[model samples]
Target chain A: MDINTVNSLSYEDFVQVFGNVVEKCPLISAAVWSRRPFTGLSDIEANIAEFIDSLPRSGQEGILRCHPDLAGKDLQSGTLTRESNEEQSQAGMTALDSVEISRMRHLNSEYKKRFGFPFVICARMNDKEAILRQLSERLTNERETELERAIDEVKKICRLRLYNLVLSDTQNKL
Target chain B: MDINTVNSLSYEDFVQVFGNVVEKCPLISAAVWSRRPFTGLSDIEANIAEFIDSLPRSGQEGILRCHPDLAGKDLQSGTLTRESNEEQSQAGMTALDSVEISRMRHLNSEYKKRFGFPFVICARMNDKEAILRQLSERLTNERETELERAIDEVKKICRLRLYNLVLSDTQNKL
Candidate 1:
């Protein structure tokens, strides 16, 4: 659906279709439905970003907690949400060897133990190599810096999801 | 879809269709797909139960954690999975007033603090009253007993979900 189609959706339908744009945080979409008559997808994105940004620190952390660990149990068991599965697949996450998988899991566990949330990257925007490299590098950052960086990655993932849904056929870019 | 239709689904399609039968624990469905050519839906149910029973304590707890709290944030914000939304609605969860909602939230929080997982119930089988009562009562149980009880509730929820998906038309039941 394009911008007009998106703008025309009823509240229930809007949430149903766009509910997962922010991963498992469909509350973001549910809240943003009230900000309808969006100028375009970016307006929708802006509304979502604003909603996410406005959350308190605990609320922000809750969003990160909702995300599954990349190439973790969910991926191994064929249990990632459809959106997550597709994003991970695009990043070659599904092709990780046993050693790579174990390393990713170990890094993800350490990251969570330190920050209380997973190491989230925009998997669609980066390959497995970059994901591993960044995971290792980011592990050294302070908690505040890592939180900001992770939320930025969330916004990037949200942007890509919105673009794919609303402008898949168009040449328009975010 | 009927049992024949269910049995014939490709592995990916099978997992996609039944992934959330045990709430967010799609791994159960993914594992059970390998035991296909089922005699009927009960066979599918049996396989799912077997797989769940096979999990270690931590894995079982992980399944419970996958569930959102009843009348919780996801419910209020329209963020529940379609199945969860329907199940909760069937149990009058969406109609909870602010006072009742707060009580449920408070109880859920306390229960989680006690057990480290959300209080899960077969919302399809019980209205808000029963759920509230059980949550209050179950809070007194030992951790081991509560874990077993919670897993039983998960199985009930799974059976109901499976029945709804595969036998929505016929009077034949689980």
Candidate 2:
């Protein structure tokens, strides 16, 4: 779909098409539905990012909490969305040895205890080893930076998901 | 990071840890290197329905042909490495409008013209709108009595240099 096609969509249809890009946060897309007539994908993206940034710290935490933990039980239980399932697998979480899964589970529990939300990252954008390394290092950071960083990661994930949702052809040439 | 210490890896080192999942693809991780281990997440997934009920074909075509289209260019550019990239992104491809890419060009040209490989149907496992509707239709296929039906889709794609890969974790559950 092109800019005009989007421009022509009803609010409900638009939300239905893009609601899950933020991972169960359909309200974001719902809120964004009225701000149509987007100049292009970037304008639309910037608006969504700004909307997320405008949220209070608690609201941002809510967004962060919405994501499932890497290698968490939600993954094996089939609770994740197609986007989430695919992203986790791309990061190579699909075939962990029983031993690796247990280690990740431990780290996930520890991180949530300290951070108040799941550790957020764009898994489609990285590999398993890289994801693990960051998981370890972020544990020592001060709360403020980690919180800001997770939001930033969420934005990136949104961008990719949006691209997949409506703009792959026009995505600035590969 | 193992059960004892994914929590301990330096970001850079942890990245080196879970980078590769598919035994055959290494460049996927290498290409994703600068992207950072993603200060917050291990993910790795690939799909190639391993129904190898027979021996090797052209042997050379076996390797080059294993990959699916990466937005359809990796086949031409020779860049698909992460086995999961092809398959996870496969759903994203389903929505690309016919004008954005032709259906037959979309069908994958080189793969069929040269080699006799079949593009296997794991679409049954995916959730994209386009994937599901096509599933029950394919189920009508006489896979055993007409092994020929399976080969037909394969021959159609070879003309495009052929196509695509990925696995899902909770996919086993669904």
Candidate 3:
């Protein structure tokens, strides 16, 4: 759909379509619906980011917590939201071997223990190697720094999702 | 959580926990947040049912469309939403052998072709034998009757989900 079409959506339709642009956090999209007449997809992205920035630490962590871990049990169990599953699969997360899977699980658990949220990178932006390297590197950062970095990655994921919704070559069947 | 705890949730937390009570239709939970301070779980369920009944036919169909097909590709590939995956598995959908799977796929597609939505049953309320019987029986139903039947099933599914959220012996960690 075009920006004009997006601009014309009712609150329900907009939320139904763009709701998962921020992973499982539809509340972000539902809240952003009030800021409508978005000039374009970027305007929508900006509004989403602004909302995320305005949240308290707990709320922001809730957003990160909403994300399924890369190569985690959700992936194994096939319960990742569609957006997350595709992104992880594209990043070769679905191809990880036994050792890599165990290592990722250990790292993911440790990271959550430290930060109280999952290690969320934009899986569409990084391959599995880059994701593994970053996971290890970021585990050493201060909590505040990691929080900012993780939310930035969320925006990247959000941007791509917005593109898929607003700039798709064909109409979104959803 | 108890009804008191449930009644105390902010719009975001309420949606986060009870959102999937209607499957992919978090918009329902988002909308229902306006009607909060629910007297108890049954009141919450009543409000949900009322909100659903208030929808136009198209909107009602939209709710049915949000459900995944029983024993379809989502189940086969492990991509069903967590609630749906579990419900389907419990109904023995996950255990369907090759022939049962093929028969289900045929009936599911045919149902969708006729009704413009997947055949939705409360999988937790039916075993495979009953589901198969109902699918065939319901397919012969008129469009309006089928729509009502399908939506009634959605409510049954929704009721169990509400119980899971509100009446669980332990506090919901979500």
What lDDT would each prediction earn against the true structure? 0.80, 0.55, 0.81
Q: Which ten residues in a row have the lowest lDDT in candidate 2 chain B?
A: B46-55
Sort the predicted structures by lDDT, highest score first: 3, 1, 2
- DockQ per candidate: 0.03, 0.01, 0.04
Q: Which lDDT tens digits does candidate 2 get at residues B74-156? A: 53464554433455355554355556345425343433332233233333245444543443344444434223444333332
Clashes of each: 0, 35, 1
Stretches of candidate 3 off by over 4 Å are A1-174, B170-174
Question: Residue B59's C-alpha lDDT in candidate 2?
Answer: 20
Ranking by TM-score: 3, 1, 2
* Interface RMSD to the true structure, each candidate: 13.9, 19.1, 10.0
Lowest summed lDDT across 10 adjacent residues in model 3 chain B is found at B165-174
lDDT of 3 by residue, A39-106 (tens): 77778889889877865454566567667779987888998888888899999999998888888999
Model 3: per-residue Cα lDDT over B3-104, one tens digit each? 777777755467779879988776567556656677777787887788778654655765676677899877878888899998998999989888988889
- Where in model 1 is the C-alpha error above 4 Å? A169-174, B1-174
Q: Is the docking of candidate 3 incorrect, acceptable, medium or high quality?
A: incorrect
Q: List A-chain TM-scores for all predictions.
A: 0.94, 0.94, 0.95
Chain A of model 1 scored by TM-score: 0.94
